[model samples]
Target: MKNIRIVITLMLTLSITISNAGTPKNDKIETPNDSLRLAELNDFWAEVSRTVSEGDFEGYKATYHEDAVVVFTTGENKGSVSIAKALRNWEQDFIDTKSGKTRNSVEFRFSQRVGDETTAHETGIFAFQSNNGTGNDNPKQFVHFNALLIKRAEAWLLVMEYQKSKATEEEWNVLE
Candidate 1:
């Protein structure tokens, strides 16, 4: 019985060692560079907001990867679409804002962010408000979103944008 117990303990120890060997040592270590990487991501989102607010269509377009995808859940629009198509649909708004026919702004608040040095998944809520120059009521619109980004050629570009659903002001405030 003593010999059997010794064998079992040794087996268990070996198994644990093997398992740990397969795991990356830095998996849970927070390196100083983590904050710097996150700051770069924050700047990426800030540029998105800035381009949209200023109606810089070309600049906004440059934020996306050439083959990016956009997913949405609006009525009659419940699937993934090419970023080019999405941009086409949204171009008129940018043009309107640029021509002074309207004013628009968007802001984002993050709930979670995960990524490595080359990739990122950002989950957040965005508030968009538009004024059509007319006296019509323009309420702020809030949305829950997840954006996947990749670092390419030292520039961060959005690869996939998932506009999940509508978000309330309360939900947006909680992230803050």
Candidate 2:
């Protein structure tokens, strides 16, 4: 009957429309790999912060790439050491200073990937405290940092970092 044909046509049209609607627009779709990269990067920094605060140098070192490069802002005071050696050097220092409520807080923003989902960059600010807790006379110092991360098999590790202390008075004045 004509009614049957009309019903079939309507059903077909509805199905087509539904399928088309569900399809993504021209906007680039973020693949699952992209999501994993973001989470891995976040977790890497999180563990770094936790390890430093807990005085677990080994745990902190585990987040870095095998051949990672690090540039420190307070190099004179903090001492410059290779990624692998730095962890060992800092381990005793961290433990010695562990009695205080010292803490390190990391805040990073997601960045764009350069080539594929396997590599990306991020930047953020860090707050470091020497006080055992928030109530101490010591204040948290702000430092700016940028990091490069590369995805390895089942892991995303920090390959490099550029770190610096807060801008100087002259630098701040120039910006103003």
Candidate 3:
């Protein structure tokens, strides 16, 4: 009986150790490389915002991957669409902005960001505002969004964009 109990205890201990060895750590400690990569990701998003604000259509297009996909989960247009199709739909807006017919700006605030050296998943709210180059009376439209990006050849390009839903200003303010 004593030998049996010792064997059972040893088996349990070994099993526990093996299980733990395969389990991922819940608490992730940010390393220096992580911080640097995050900074680069921030710069990537800033470039997106800057391109939209300045009506740089070519620059904006460069932010996305060649085979990017966009998932729209709000309103009547709730479906997956190719990035090229979505860009075609928004081409007029870009043209208008570039022609000084409208001024637009987009700002992002993240609630969560997780990623490694080459891939990232960012969840956040984006506030897009547009005016007819008149004044600051344009209402800011906020949307909850999740963006999946991958770094390729020194450039971070969006692979998938999930526009989840419309977000209230209150919800937008809660995230920084």
Candidate 3: worst 10 consecutive residues by lDDT? Answer: 132-141
Candidate 1, run of 10 with poorest lDDT: 25-34
Single out the weakest 10-residue window by summed lDDT for candidate 2.
167-176
The root-mean-square deviation over C-alpha atoms between each candidate and the true structure, in angstroms, is 4.9, 10.8, 4.2
Which residue pairs of candidate 3 clash? none
Tens digit per residue, CA lDDT, model 2, 26-58: 656778877776667667777877877777766
Candidate maximizing TM-score: 3
* Per-residue lDDT over 8-118 for candidate 3, one digit per residue giving the tens place of the 0 to 100 score: 999999999998897788767799888988999989989999989888898999999999999999778999999999999888788888898899999999998898899
- Please provide TM-scores, in order, for all candidate models, with all chains considered together: 0.83, 0.60, 0.84
If both were scored by TM-score, which would come out higher, candidate 1 or candidate 2?
1
Per-residue error at 138 for model 1, in Å?
Answer: 1.2
Which regions in candidate 1 have their CA more than 4 angstroms from the true location?
A: 1-29, 135-137
Best by lDDT: 3
Report backbone clashes per prediction: 0, 3, 0
| Superposed Cα deviation of residue 46, candidate 2 (Å) | 1.5
For model 2, state the Cα shift of residue 78 in Å. Answer: 10
